[model samples]
Target chain A: MKMAIAKQEVRALSGDEAVAYAVKQSDVDVVAAYPITPQTIIVERFSEYVHNGEVDTEFICVESEHSALTACLAASATGVRTFTASGSAGLALMHEILYVTSGCRAPVVMAIVNRALSAPINIHCDHADSMVERDAGWIQIYVENSQETYDSVIQAFRIAEDPDILLPTMVMLDAFVISHTLESVKVLPDDIVRKFVGTRQIPLVKNHEGKLVPFKLDPENPVTMGPLDLYDYYFEHKRQQEDAMQRASQKIKQIHDEYGEITGRRYGNGLINPYRLEDAEIAAICLGSTAGTAKTVVDQLRAKGVKAGLLRLRAYRPFPAQDVTKVLENVKAIAVMDRSHSFGAYGGPVFHEVRHTLYDAATHPQIVNYVYGLGGRDMPQTLIHEIYKELQKILETKRVKKPVRFIGVRE
Target chain B: MTAKQKGWKELPIAGLCWKPSTEYFTGDWRTFKPMLDEEKCTKCLICYIDCPDVAVKWKPEDEKIEFDYNFCKGCGICANVCPSEAIKMVLE
Candidate 1:
């Protein structure tokens, strides 16, 4: 069912500004954040909104990222929409509470400006910040551009707050590439965004007194959240979280489709957005802004009758294993690009998951991992073409001699 | 008798504990128990104030202080804090 696209205004905004715009229009009740590189602009812009009285959100400037998400978690527990943004070391600081927020079932929406974790203190694009938290039980969405960043941030709130899946969500945009770069983003009017996100519907739970009340920290009817569940019940709660994550894949698709109806813009099923995968003999799988570059490469390869395709992973937490399998089933050779590499591991994080996902398939493609662009390195078009050329060699040879290769790196 | 343990689906989402903490008997974990001597009690209520688990029950109407061992972990804080040394800790 298709609905008419809502009227929108075109604005040149950076990826950070796009997230702020979406949160501002979503009528977020609270925003607690600490300014970090690339992610700082998001809170800076939102703080301006708070100062100008543009929105009624309580903007909290926390001392550290840990306190920022901790405050957001507490605020979200009270049944109000909350938001925060962080990256790199800041995201690392919030690592402990990331699990606590999801375990408490607080639907706090966060924007992660993906940045390289510091060893030499480099502030550049990488997936290490968010990828490390993949098992933290939050719904993770990676966007290709500023426009999708704006659209996904709005969709994230609805997806997280769905009663069937009350998990915290983090929308990731590449640092510098998307966060600092300006692009034309079509933003829905405030009222339309508000109407689309709607209000957070608090589910009812039985209280201590056996009275059914809304699931929130209410003084009138108190309930303990993030309480101690030792051996007697800890495993069951974890299982319940897994259940919600499984439910989130379908919920994300549903919400993405619903948003598409109003905006007339949709990524491929909101899980895995396939670009020219149909009837292609070779394809590459990637995440974040790299997809934008890979798409151009795929188009170029297709022009030369190379039958090359690209599969952009939009949702990573739910993993979208089924969509990935279906999209790359016919392809003979594939490349899994990782902007972040797992030190001393067989391959990057994405490669491990993608390989494990296809282990049970009837016929598996010759899949290889290419760990590239770590610590803000540039992944030019020529490098992506090199990856495809490598895939072509793998297809002809029908064997993977070296399963993991680091591209564009002097090794 | 222990109530039936809830299955994963029946458990509140995210393990929200709506039931009071008293439902779990912490006394079973006690390695030591606090014994009170009513004659040595000075009614200072210091033990009641010091007990972390609120196991030291104080009935102000009758000026009676007693220990509710059911919820007590037998931490011995009350025995340590008792001004009159009315409470003593012994192996349970």
Candidate 2:
């Protein structure tokens, strides 16, 4: 089945600008953000819109990323749509509240310009920032370029605020690669976006007193949020979040399908964005801007009669395990590229999950993990080609010489 | 109780505290209750503004402030805030 790519006016925009425009069009009630590399432009642009009276939004420039998220939590608890953005250390600083936001089920939308986490201190593209928080209970959607960044931000609000899934979501784009790189993007009119996002759905829940009340901080309803729960009920609350994530996987696909009907842009089933994976002997799986690069390599290899394909993991939090198993089951060999390393683990986060997902499959493909593009290092087309060549070797010999290899990094 | 046993029906949706603070009668926790000495009492109403819990209520018939013992924790903040020493914390 072909995706309906919507016809609209194309605007030249960087990924950051695209996200900013989406936030603007979303009619967000509040934006609480702190400036960080790559992520700075997003809140900055939105603040300008707030300043010029282009949109009605409460723009809060907080002292730290922690406060920025705290403000978002407060605003979200008040039953209003809220947004924020950060990267690298900024995201790390807000790590504690990230859990609070989801645990509280605030449904805050955040734009994450993915950047390398610090040791020696670097501000460039890497998945380390978002990958570290993979288990934070937030719905994570990684984007390929400016267009996807724009599209996903709008969809994120719908997905997050869904009654079944009252969870926060982050739209992650590779730092600089997609965040700063300019591309042509078709932006939907503000009214269309406003109608699509609609009003926030704050479900009524029964409290301890057995009264049905709005699940928000309202004076009339008088509900309390973020109370200390010990052994009596904390675990049940976590399970609620888990069930929400499972429901989210299905809801995300549903929202994407409905969104595609209007906008004509769809990511492969809203989980895995696959390119020419059918009848392929070799394949590579990655996320973010690298997928675009890998697809280019796929096209080049296909011209030479090599069966190469690409799988871009659009939704990372849910992991899309079933889709990965179904798509990669037939391939002879596969390379899982990760922009972040898992320290001393067997492989990077994506690699480990991909390998684990394939274990229960009827057919197993020779899988190799390649740790690449750390610290904003360039992932040239040649490196992606080399990975496919390595996959080809594995197919011919039916062996994986190295389970995990560092790509473009000195040993 | 274990979380697994709580079940979906019993789970609190979005962590909303089911019991609003007002619902809990904290008066039982009080070790000392504020006793007003009407003879020495001044009609300043300073105790009304200084009561942390808003437990001090103004009686229209008496034209004096009376504490609502149902919600009062008896922390003695209102007694201390009383300038005329008209109110004092007494053992419950």
Candidate 3:
């Protein structure tokens, strides 16, 4: 069914309120999340929905994200749609169960308000937390603004629950950029959202008594899920996950396209969002909220007639290896702007994977890594411009001391 | 029309420290064993339901079942689930 957008008054909403609207629009049966900032307000508002009986969901106040997702695990197992949200440390707490949620093939979608991992304590945006968890088998969808944050999460449920792609997915927005930005989001009417999202009818296997139950997951389908996967079947499980992931990238695109048809909102989901790359000799690769700043830099560079483009990665896991190859193969030079770094790796962790994806290509772009915005460093548009100019010099010099550059470093 | 593959393994009380001298499990005396009746044997599927661990593996094709005591924490679920009265609990 086509969505009917109402001419609702354009009111400013915090990122958390956008998430609450998305959850209610999707008609999520359960919201099991704990308190953590900037994420605390999301569930706090959801708790209000529970008390007011506006949303008939089991709004569970879990002890931790681990417990929240664990309860979501059992809840999703019984075949109810579920949601939860968390930030850096809370995302870290649910690390082990994240694998379980995906391995069990539970289609649980979550919103992650991107926060810097705590030590000296910063609560703004960075790619460190989710970037480190790139192999956890959940599709990571990054939104640049609050409007996309509100939209992507509802599509997260639709994509995760699609039978062709029954895996968990995480919708991410920077702690401040989208999480704090107020935009005029055209939220589809709830009933229209319902039409786009059909009611879930899980197959019921009746027990001997009149009451029905799910038949035990039988091996007769010749599918052994989450088994020990000893040497005999180990490679196949990895292969299946990889296969499912490649399929998931395409699935994400399909979901985005369908959501586009419904609400005139579109997201390019093949790892990177390419802008002005049609025939550019140089481009900047970025992820998360940095993309918003990077886009401004791209505009300034273009205004100066600098042949530049921007590749904003939206899906980070399964690392979009193939898609990165196709997009970056033509550009003469590329500089990766990263917000997180591996302590002693050749470059920041994000740079390492983007390079790996291009390793086997026939020809490769001159890729360089720039680690910026560490510990809440303010990476404004000019610094991003300076970094691109530096990449220009490196490409011009044709010789570099190292492939990776940590931009905005005081030292 | 055809029989499913039936696999079995002989589990021994080694490394697990199944010492008969220790009269109670961890000295709590809550753990017990479900003694099976060799005579009054009707293969009813009750004990499988009551096992908290769901440890009782009743093979419908072969009509044979076995238990791995290592994982069986003696919850006595099988004793309660057995409708044939073919099982009884013996304290550790």
Candidate 4:
């Protein structure tokens, strides 16, 4: 008889449940939360955990999203991990404090739970809220499915707490698509989650001969922070943030690979996850929940004799300029599906930036944006096929379609 | 000597050099300005306690308090929250 080795089992979970599971796994000593559209349920389960004694955390019921983040930041700053969730108006309230947490480099992990911004108050699925905060310095990882949402939440702690990148991250998941949807997921055990995430070392603090001195700053050897800089250190500060942003990409990728080893789940966070683009003519560049639809469209298009591919973006921050240029240079056409509109000048924020990044390149593909799903419009996979066909037409005739291709809308 | 230079000797302790006739965010010039009326006054430290931004300071001598305007943003909350109604927002 052959001896069998002991191995752990995996289970299925919905996005909200997965989030609660992830929060539990992160060993979050404090849970600060407020009720907001789409993201409310994620914290609802967390509250249940606290009530049932499933999670031993100081669950702080906050008045508003601003206080939720403030409490999370304050808690995490004092040498313990913290978690929270918000979307749309709630996120807007927390906007100013987001930069403060980033500036202070607090490793408070949160789930943005992507939803459409208010006014008419329609909430389903869109990247509007998350895209609006592109420069908040929070490392964003947009997930496509419920399993990935759960997985991304777990991975967020590992990535955020990395000493080289002691920065907060917002795991952005589509409101109804992933946040409310149910899917089979492998929820890692708490012990394994603890082992994988490890302990976080609080930032800007160091002990010297029994005295607690701040790490990133000097008080006894004093230095002022955020001083209104003239020409001297202004550029240097910008360069410092840019360098950290650059370093974060590689750190994120390394953590992804490590998580893959430990948990058998990995996310390609290097801006683009290229599918069948090795010898393809056109590649569809997309981000967030739309990538799932685009991937299916790519398979169908490929089956019907179209030499096209997919580049599902996972990490939009520290935008992967070099990799995008290198991979997209030789392609005849690249259709960027923009779920977020930039109002004018460009169709969407991600589409606008990607087009600009690839514009000056020698053999770059003709980039066209398909701005779809605004105010929670339906984006069927068949529309992605139509968008790709339109891209093919644009490739044949070099005529730009007003810099935007609005697909399947009443207007 | 000019009256401005002569004024320093007349001041009590820690001869004040700060100005309040100028402003930052709010335009009320003497918004945080110290008024040493030395009349109709009970110099309680209530103003200092109500100041969220710590714009007010309490001095020990004669229980009098002076304002520092070099860093004050002239938020006007100080004057509005003053219990004694001693501080007033005035145009420069």
Model 3, runs deviating above 4 Å: A1-9, A201-238, A269-271, B1-92
For A1-411, candidate 1 gives per-residue lDDT tens digits of 567899999999999999999999999999999999989899899999999999999988889999999999999999999999999999999999999999999999999999999898989999999999999999999999999999999999999999889999999999999999999999999999999999999999998777898999999878877777787789999999999999999999999999999999999999999999999999899999999999999999999999999999999999999999888889989999998988999999999999999887766799999999999999999999999999999999999889999998896
lDDT ranking, best first: 1, 2, 3, 4
lDDT minimum window of 10 residues, candidate 1 chain A: A223-232
The residue pairs in collision within model 3 are none
Interface RMSD in angstroms for candidate 4: 18.7
Question: How do the residues A136-187 of candidate 3 rate in per-residue lDDT, one tens digit apiece?
Answer: 8888888777777887888888888876566789988888777777777767
**Model 2 segments more than 4 A misplaced:** A1-7, B1-5, B19-92
Candidate rank order under DockQ:
1, 2, 3, 4
Tell me the docking grade of candidate 4.
incorrect
Best candidate per DockQ, number?
A: 1
What is the C-alpha DockQ of each candidate? 0.61, 0.40, 0.04, 0.03
Better of 1 and 3 by lDDT: 1
Residue A45 in candidate 2 has what lDDT? 87
Model 4 chain A poorest ten-residue lDDT run: A204-213
lDDT score, candidate 4: 0.72
Clashing residue pairs in candidate 4 (N, C-alpha, C atoms within 3 angstroms): A12-A185, A204-A215, A205-A215
Show where candidate 1 strays beyond 4 Å.
B31-92
State which candidate has the highest lDDT: 1
Residue A408, model 1: lDDT of: 87
**Using TM-score as the measure, which candidate wins?**
1
lDDT of model 4, residue A388: 83
